[model samples]
Target: MHFEQANRATGRLVTTGEVGASGASDSELTTGRFDGQDGHGGEDGHGGKGGQGGQGGQDGRGDQPWFELWNVQQGLWLQHQLGESRADSNLPLWQHLHETLDLAAFRKAVSFLVDRHQALRLSFQDTADGPRQRVLPVHDLDVPLVDLTGLADPEAEVDRLIRIESATPFDDLGSPPVRVKIYRLASDHHCVFVNVHHIIADGTSMGILLRELLLCHRAFAAGEEPPLAPLPKTFEAFVQDRQQWLSGTQSKSMETYWLDQLAAPLPRLRIGDYEAPADDVVNETLEFWVEADITEGLGALAKELHVTLHILLLSAFVVALRDISSDDDIVVCVPFFGRDTKDLDGMVGNFVNPLSVRMKMSGSDAFDDVVRRARSASIGSYANSRYPFTRLLEQVDAEARPGRNPVFSSAFQFTRFLPPAKQTSQLDLCLYGRPDGERIKLRFNYNSRRLAESEIREVQSCFQAVLRRILGDAAISLDSLSEPLRQARRTMRAAPRDGRRLGRLRGSRSTTPDA
Candidate 1:
């Protein structure tokens, strides 16, 4: 699970950290009492140093390493999606084929994914204590699988297992790219436990893993070894290419714009009433999804307005926040997939970072005007989007609000375009439940993982209202989104929805009432 770092100049292994107790089960070596005060320091026992830590490994070609090219702290972390199964699910497809989890095939798949992606094979080396990147050959990422059939209620059991499995973070330069623990609940029921160094994988990579898992599984089951296509290029290539393309002048301009944006005293827009904390785990999440139709509408509007869908979404969100808080100046974190590199598609590593979308809204600004502003902000951020949100925070040394998010209220993200839901061969999967009655804080974090179908529809309702108010009355200001924004505001902060499950939506009305 751990390896000593190899001396770059000597090309010999240099050991560090207490060599873990020999043959220690990942559980045993990783087990420890963390009071939350100790933080994750103990877990990262010198195994995988992400871009933020060590000097990333370089290539023999004297080229820039892929790890260095991507934003530091961006290429670390993975996303997983858990959904309900339906009787009408695609179980037949799975049943038509053998559904066995073969280790050899899995290893081949892992090796292929790692070799194809530069981020996975990237490592750091040293010269006179100055460490840099050393890209390693792609090899099969070996992860010992523990069969936890003895444990009942696998979900609950797996949660405990994740805590233990993730206790020891990847700290050393390069040993195992990813650690996976497979929990098989039944012949047809199983869960994949994956622990990726936040430096190499992000939410997008998770989608890639699931898709390839099924694709590889099918090919293996069919008794045919699929000949994998070679990667168009690697992350290392990307670094060299991007740097060349954005030489001195272009880089300076981008850097200057970003610096000026950060020059302002960052707005601390409070979303909730919580006593600031000395230091807290602070898993502030904002979960909501736009409806399929509304998403289409936004896409259409973006096309018409000559902006990206993300820009439109960000604009509406800013308008909503400004209206609710009655603050003209606001900021929110927007997570971007920082690929900016060609030939990075299908790479199974973290390549995401947060960007600050600072909106300077005016009371008199029209909704369309706000849209234009939001679009402009996104484009500008992209031009000067080299630094990670973490780096920006570090630069400012911004004091985090005691119990709240440091910079702004929370984060906003959309994930509908990820791999579609898959059908299984075994049990019928139909979700029937309601959210628990808990007062979620407003300093919310939004991503694709948490929202339900009904909730997605509700969000659509609000967006529709906002869009109607905007387009219907061109003179209306971005403040017009306030009414529809209130619907979601009410649902999230108001009393819980009657906790209904799988109920048909009652209204089929257009957003315009007087139409």
Candidate 2:
């Protein structure tokens, strides 16, 4: 989800700290507990060591081997170096988990995870040339156990700490790229706050870390060896492979393909219905859902049209965008999974890449026609998806405008990977939909500076209408679908004209595009 423009001339590190009401620096609260107070020594076990910046050589000062960073990682590092290290930046992952847990066993589980995953132990540095990373060699963790059992509002205090820590930027990227805080609310109630920078972990890595940690914790609690598979291939190995691929002819072909896919003057997404200073982006997410039967109809429509459910959802999004922006040519970046081979199955890092899925639409286009275009575009982009988005921005020569991302204004993805939504530098709106049981969970993460809460709600209403109208008829005119929905928003809270099921989908027919 990280976005940035590359090729900056110079960068400077920005170290930030928060002065709490108690006058203790938040950084002190952050690192003070882990300075070997709990049996382990002060050198926290993040496994970081000094290395040649991006040179991939062992440091003479007695550190470890360095790996040349990927293009997206370098972009994120440069942004961080130049002071884009805000809570709204699309680089930090924050989550809180509650369960009955023993502190010692939890600490042991985290320590085991840190040892097993080299990515969790990574550290970065900004050099004159650029930023690079190296893996630390340690295998243990010193977790700060914050006891809030007797506080007047223990739950509220845990929430406060999470907010403060989530806002607390990682000043020194050269330290451990991960932070873990355990808040004890009661003997049986606990909260686990985990924040990891996107440099070493993506959405997928979050699941891997938690799953492995819980597995290890259960085994330790039972005095049994953890039943975990050996990670034969480490993150460093994947880095080498990626660097090799980025240098070869395949990369050249991919660059060529993307450069052609995203031609000049990429269209802007102005559907947010307002314009403000682009620099002042804040994250606001509005969530809604489509009825279960209509969700089934969407699946049925995709099946009838011979396209994946993702493409179908994307086509619906395109219809909505064309209506609002009035742009015949729309580009929506679709983030793709880049762990191509099974060798990378065990390795986790920043491997997700954005595929620029450009669709050409007209008011006269049918739902089937839009889906065809979307499907083709998704296929084309996925084929060349490994070309880093930052590098693609370079070749695409997108305007490095003050407010928005250099490439696409909006992004859409069908994924189960749900994080707290926020607006970033590159997106005006990020529309995500995933299947939840029989229903579709839709979340619209928007930049509040560019969009109003009412505007976002209108979008949700219109999108719901689109989903329903499409089921009743895929060949329904775009204008028919749009005008009715737009009016639906202005009038009142939308209810199904034909009841809760919306328009009941008829039996499947030939939605295939005309040859």
Number of the top lDDT candidate: 2
Q: Estimate, for each residue in 273-356, the C-alpha lDDT of model 2 and write its tens digit.
A: 334576777768988887788888888888788776778888888777765555677888765445554444555566666657
**Model 1, residue 219: C-alpha shift (Å):** 4.3
TM-score for each candidate, following the candidate numbering: 0.58, 0.78
User: For every model in order, what is the number of clashing pairs?
Assistant: 37, 2
* lDDT of each residue in 1-515, candidate 1, tens digit only: 11111101100000001112333221221121112221122111122221211211212223333234344432121111111111111101111112457666666555555544556666654345333454664445675655666766765775566546544545454453465555565555555555455445554565555566556655766677544454444455544444453455645565566557756576654323222232322222223344455455655666777665555566766665565445577776654455543334555544454566688876568877877776556555554554444444555545655323455544444322311122111111111111122211111222222233334444434544665455455357654455556655456443224353311222211332311
Candidate 1, position 236, lDDT: 52
Predicted structure 2, TM vs. truth: 0.78
| Model 2 CA deviation exceeding 4 Å by range | 1-62, 89-102, 272-275, 422-425, 479-486, 489-515
As a whole number from 0 to 100, the lDDT of residue 187 in candidate 2 is 79
lDDT of 1: 0.44
